[model samples]
Target chain A: MREEADVVVIGGGVTGCGIAYNLAKKGLTDVIVLERQVPCVGASGRCGGGIRQQFTTDANITLAMESVRLFEQLSVELDTDIEYEQGGYLIIAYEDEVDQFKRNVRLQNSLGLESRFITPEEAREIVPLLNIDPIAGATFCQTDGHANPFRVVHGYARKAQKMGVEISKFTAVTGIVVEDGQIRAVKTDKGTIKTNTVVNAAGAYSRDIASMVGVSLPNKPYRHEILVTEPVEHVLDPMVISFKTGVYFSQQKHGPIIGGIGDPEEPSSYNISASLRFMKRMARTVVELVPAFGHLNVLRQWAGLYDVTPDAQPVLGWTEGVDQFCQANGYSGHGFMIAPKVTELIAELIVDGKPSMPIDDLNLKRFEGEITGEAYVVG
Target chain B: MTEIVCRCEDITEEDILDAIDQGYTTLEEIKRVLRCGMGPCQGRTCIPLITRIVARKTGKSLAEVSRPTTRPPLQPLPLSVFAGEEE
Candidate 1:
């Protein structure tokens, strides 16, 4: 790799590529992105690919709303097919979460989103295959959808490379050299790159990068597994999500039903091994939600790590001691959905010194105090 | 050339035994050496079958024979996604 110049972005997933693309657009050429493996080798490639604006918090909803707008024009802007489909996201709620679902819908409505609370029967109308017996209430947003994760990251990486951003795959960063509270260079297995700015976008390994700079980040990595069923005739239209079960499923454009479930008790580690426990739990929940899923054969299963913060919000902007180091990590499980907007803000922060959008609440300092509301709609 | 176990990669029971003869013991190692379960299905079809073969060959239980470490890009993707256009 070249000796490097302006900015060094770690992690070649969607977020890192998104940052590189935005930074290159800002005329910051000589950008280097380092990925330990191929792009989308982590959670970005393994996620459910569900882009939803139906969030309980304004921060998440706003981020998703802006990202959806970008995704609408991405295929043309990036000159590649992202396979984006706006089949919408249907969030069904049990009796316990009905109040929270109603409040979330009202909050989403106040922000000019067309999200609304619908009866269980209306949910069935949207997805006829759904078993609505257990669903007490539901929320629907037509703007939410899923895209091909591989295509999305590849588009960003390809578009950024065309703009003079160098993405080095299989380049593992061993350490970050910081001197007197300023970043000096990033040490990698390939070679050392002298840089004044470092964007620690290393998804699950963000904490490890932070510790190298003598800073501590509260983000932990948890294994989240997903499986796909054999492709069949189009049956499900929208991504069906349940907060209580932490399970979500959606039909891809190619026909496979892809989805995953979260185990809260799963310890923080980099173990990506898929478990039979998850398979059994997912089958039980999915079949209960849509009885037709019981007949479909499961084709494959895999796991990815979620870089989660305590409050489930991302820690953006500059850290305290590291002057030249900026962070755009800790997106929890929804990083793929909000990547475009978050990376745009990170680009603004790196080049123009401030983001056009306000993300003051999303910082590491917020974790020092008693952290209140979390992004409860995690799947 | 016996019954096909891994439909994704078209690997059969005889192929699996040959893989064992070649010293590919673990599920992950066998996948790398023989391509037994490394296909579009990512071993979902052949893991159980291969587990049985490895267990019976090595005289170990299925639980003792650990599965291979699942790497990223769990599914096969086109190389064009990475190969930059000729300028």
Candidate 2:
């Protein structure tokens, strides 16, 4: 069926679904979201779902705080069990990063985040099995947590649909129809969708989606792989991050040790095959961080592409020379966490033409010279 | 007399071997042409069994056989699920 809408939201991941839901909730009904393949089939479901407010930049912190607040009330808000736990985020400061961690704690506190410096004894209390040796000081934040990404994304999409927002899954957005320096419509494999407003919320494929409209978004897709062990009895509570090893992990409520380390030199390609290099690095880092995880057998491993922008900051808002177009991509690897807030901001911008929060710092032009540097060195 | 590899689609060892002989190096290529493990459960229910068959037959190491392309819908939920069909 040929279709048209007030806004044509691209990609059915969490970010896209968030925009759709918020828009509909804010009284815009004629919105249709197009998903190439299926909802949460991209980076949303494949991510580690680590939510944190301890960030270095103002924009990142703002988005993360907003997202954490939304997530805290999301179970009742969405009428779906997202399994969000506010069990705090712990970053183990080992070796030389102790100084960096202290600086980060100061900045986070100045920004009114409830993060602090803790002794190794306090760190051991949170995670008993964690090897505290080679540790300087541990940075702790009570607000950071995790949720089920699939459930959250799907829940948002479901709510959007029930509210009269049309979501077409397995429908690929083939191209964008731009004319007179304005977005005319979006073309799909099935048919064409005529709309003035377009949101490029297409996760890892956001770069490709932007290119469809003749915009050069400086985002490259990088492969990041993660593995999970068989569910064990609850052995840990807080999620652990090592500034030294670039590894982050947490044992879920279902009790499978789930996490992945940042591979510094992951190439810009979609090669998601399980690699020996990834496995060895992940295994070594996880084992070193938590010695108790040594005995657990990894049930499976998988990979997904991170929509990495230069400087690892998210590129949000309207594209250059584009009318009625918005971008909520280039989140590096942190898309899953702040997706709700980011998408909500996009929705607000679409409906009210500006949000209550200041999204100016997150503008796409920041990559050129609008330097607002973020601090949270998370993967 | 090789055993069946793709437990989901029931494409056997001999079928995969013949496909390999025809130059299908990637599991995705074999899946596309032979429809081996591209069933309802995706390769989740079939991959381990297929990997054993591939490793034993080709004499490739387990690590080599373990490295298969991981596509989306990692858990094999229906497309209708994403469509919010409520079935």
Cα lDDT over the full model 1: 0.83
What does DockQ give for each predicted structure?
0.04, 0.03
**Where does model 2 sit among the CAPRI classes?**
incorrect
Q: What are the per-residue Cα lDDT tens digits for candidate 1 across A183-259?
A: 88999999999999999999999999899878999999999998776667898888889888999999988687889
- Position B34, candidate 1: lDDT: 50
Find the candidate with the highest DockQ and give its number: 1
Residue A169 of model 2 has an lDDT of 69
**Residue A64 in model 2: shift from native, Å?**
0.8
TM-score of 1: 0.83
Candidate 2: residue B54 lDDT (0-100): 66
| Alpha-carbon DockQ of candidate 1 | 0.04
Span of ten consecutive residues with least summed lDDT in model 2 chain A: A370-379
